[model samples]
Target: MDTHTGRRRTDTDAADRPADPAFERRLLAQVERLIAERGSVLAAQGRSLADLGDVEEFAERMVAALPTRHPYDESLGPFYDTAGLVTWLGVSRQAVADRVRRGTLLACRTADGHLLYPSLQFGRDGQVRPGVFEAVGEFTRRGVDGWAVALWLTTASEAFEGHSAVDFLVLHRSSAAAVQRVVEVATADAQSWVA
Candidate 1:
């Protein structure tokens, strides 16, 4: 039974439903939430969902546009699988996803469709750095992918004076100025990347 629409869901509802109903439902919900959230801003900017045209083509193009993985990827990980993150943070899997959605944690989907969080993001204290939340939130808000966000945080940036964001963040973890710098540069970088 469907409470929101007062209509029961039936197998015949759509011939195009994917094989995994649960995964499909979760993904659909995420997309709907994003669309609803971004719809107004996109409209004001003279854009519409139709601008994406074909979903498959859009996905392929987005994938193609991502920054290439550099050698830094190996240093960025010791990634935490969902189960390990759940045990480490004492949070449920859904809670983990919620945090990722909120941009307070970094997660990138593996090729097999599982989310993995880098151990480096939490440092040794089991807490996400202050600047990280703001930077990632800005990046994701600008329509950048999570993989790109992770890469941006790890890759060396000449703008940061030959230091990666993670390095600068660690060196000045408690500095408000540094955090603001991260947020500013992150949004700028995200804009250029999307453009």
Candidate 2:
């Protein structure tokens, strides 16, 4: 209500809306870069834009194929801070830090210098799965960063018969050798690119 004018106020003014030109510009730039990159990769593989059949389908696939990276400041998260982890694992904050230091847990540091642990490492029983730590150790040994390791654990890989490393781990909890194979194969491919 507009008490000063003695009249009821309604949301009819367009000027009340906030401007978002910066966000729009950033989104436009990212989309343009993705399209250009995807086009080049497709061309290299003998699959032209025409082979996509439809523009919308191609856009969908391109989005799906986009690499998953850590968004440092955004609220969209499956991440847990120290306090949350303490509660979740029924352990002290120091214990969490110790686990991270020992490479028994996977953690990503945010721009604010806070460590955020990926929720995927915990099972339904609130315990860190055994294979996750082993995979993290292997990734660390092969020079993979924590973010890439987290993404590799979650993302579907052809090496695992189209199943993600985490999925295979959950399905075959006792088979550490299978997870080791996936890690070795991925690490070797990454190294070959470096060579």
Candidate 3:
């Protein structure tokens, strides 16, 4: 019931009150028509909203549509280069060149081209003890992300056994200090994920 209009209104009409039914219907019809028209246009262009099922496809399309060097297309953090680092570290390479290229790790090549990293530098190329990797792998198996593993290893001051070598650094050091080193290396190894 509309007090001002002094007429009974349907529930749907009342829900859309203050809006004329004819106008509302026309507006909705127009919107639907527009959607259909646009959908057809997109289909003609070999694309459609229907094809975008999961977020991955949508994101892929968005990325594919991006022009070169767009800031939005770039990764924003230190761990962005983790894949390469993990590979190099696994291969027993010093990985200084890789880290330097990423610009997130810091080190100087010695006269003989040997890389020098401070003992406390987390991302610096160092031998990953077997137990350390096991500890990290345990954390990962338990659904821990890199941040959590790094946090526990660097902050908790506890020895862990896992398949990822990250735990070794944490086991031998206080978590706080280890975390600090991780931060330093992240900054120094910019874009280098290996460290």
Candidate 4:
């Protein structure tokens, strides 16, 4: 409820609210600038940015493709904070931090810079789903930020048979080829970031 108005908060209100129009554009502009700067550095080293492949189109498509319906879109969350997760997992705070730092656990930083573990990382048993550590490590190893990794994993892909990577991992846990395919896609995504 909104204390001042004595009314409940609803999805309708959220949908009615105006989103920040310039945020995505600003981010796109920053990425474009980064690509240009990278191109400059590569040129100095006798290389070309052409290898990145249609950088502008790639950036715009990614931004446009961002999922618009997640609960996170409404709130930046109470998403599995470390202290709470430690209780649930029966581990010390240091262990959780270590896992996140090592990329064995997926975590994204809030605007205020606290790491919040996405709820998707946990299964119904309160354990992390299999193959998560490997996938998270793959992205982090190649400079893909945690938030982007989380988004990529959640997005439905035709490559994963119209399912997200998480579902594919769960359903194909025993298939070595399937697991390897996930890793390969992660590597490809990393290559995009490397561009």
Which residue pairs clash within candidate 4? none
lDDT digits (tens) for residues 91-129 of candidate 3: 323454554444333333334443332222243344433
Count of backbone clashes, every candidate in sequence: 0, 0, 21, 0
Model 3: worst 10 consecutive residues (lDDT sum): 68-77
Residue 96, model 2: lDDT of: 82
TM-score of each: 0.59, 0.52, 0.23, 0.57
**lDDT per model vs. reference:** 0.69, 0.64, 0.40, 0.68
Worst 10 residues of 1 by lDDT: 62-71
The alpha-carbon RMSD values of the candidates against the true structure, listed in the order shown, are 17.7, 18.4, 23.0, 20.1
lDDT of 3: 0.40
Q: Give Cα distance to truth, residue 84, candidate 2, Å.
A: 0.6
Q: Can you write out model 1's per-residue Cα lDDT over 143-169, one digit (the tens) per residue?
A: 677788888888888877788887887
lDDT of 4 by residue, 143-171 (tens): 67888888888888988888778778877
Candidate 2 backbone collisions, by pair: none
